[model samples]
Target: MSASELPYQYIVLRCVPRPEREEFVNVGVVLYCQASDFLQAGWRVDVERLHALDPRVSTDQVCAALEFIDAVCAGDPRGGAASEQPRGTRFGFLKAPRSTVLQPGPVHGGVTTDPARQLEHLVSTLVG
Candidate 1:
């Protein structure tokens, strides 16, 4: 049977520069569509708000991490071997939780006909 929609998963990257202080700001988002072999990420950070959250929050560090997410989405060499794998695998790598200034949030799933549009919707609703 043909399918009109497919299930996908996503994670929002959060910056917790001051984890001890229990502060975090959403920095980016990662989305994966296994059926379509598509993986993409989008990010937007409010520097002033980030600084207000933690004066020590480093924009350079967060930007680099966000860029890394984009590179993984593009399968760029900068993303290393993980990005060279299939899109689903790349998504897995990106979605893995990490203890750092920037890290992926819990994985959320939904159905979508267009992964790109879903990505935009996720960014706007969850992180925008």
Candidate 2:
């Protein structure tokens, strides 16, 4: 890797309407670059798509979860104690597996100088 490139890791966030059936919709992405001290999240909710998967899914709850991701990434007080940790700890917390409507896909890695742009690209390609 060139000096201009920095290592980063990311996870594609998923909205699992029905965990028992294992059905999910790609919703967002969280990315962290330690070298650059960058952490951010980008997301979009396709209400129509989510409804098609499960008409009973609560769009409001899904959106609230996504907002929490953003707040955590920004280290905002609204994110609660999780946002108080260091950036790396915050990333680990977000990526940890959990049984919830909003779930992390898997950890993926790559090199990029611009973590923000890479985050946008990941969200567009992986979540869209």
Candidate 3:
């Protein structure tokens, strides 16, 4: 990678209505570039798509969780102590595997000169 390009890691956020069923709907993305001290999250919830997976899925809860992720990325006071952690630590907390309605998918890596733009691109390409 060129000097201008920085390595970044990201995770696709998913809404797993039924973990037992092993199904999920892409709801958001979290990205971090330690080299550039950048971290952020982007999200969108398709109600129709989520209901199709499980009629009982709670969009509000999913949204709240996703919002928390965004807060953490932004180091917002609303995110509490997690947000106060170092950026890399916050990213690590987010990318850790979990079994919940709102959980992250596998971690992926790439190189980019603009971490923010790459985050938007991933949200469009993978979470859409």
Instruction: Please tell me which predicted candidate would have the highest TM-score against the true structure.
Output: 2
Q: All candidates' lDDT scores?
A: 0.87, 0.95, 0.93
lDDT of 2 by residue, 18-117 (tens): 9998989999999999999999999999999999999999999999999999999999999999999999999999999999989999899999989999
TM for every model, in the order presented, reads 0.93, 0.98, 0.97
- Which is superior by TM-score, 1 or 3? 3
lDDT-best of 2 and 3: 2
lDDT of 1 by residue, 57-84 (tens): 7899899988888988999999888879
Candidates 1 and 3: which is better by lDDT? 3
Locate the minimum summed-lDDT window of 10 residues in model 2: 119-128
Off by over 4 Å in 1: none
lDDT measured at residue 50 in model 3 versus the true structure, 0 to 100 = 98
lDDT of 3 by residue, 74-128 (tens): 9998898999999999999999888889988899999999999999999999888
- Identify the runs in model 2 with alpha carbons over 4 angstroms from their true place: none
Candidate closest to the true structure, highest lDDT: 2
How does model 2 fare in lDDT? 0.95
Candidate 3: how many backbone clashes? Answer: 0
- Give candidate 3's error at residue 73 in angstroms: 0.7
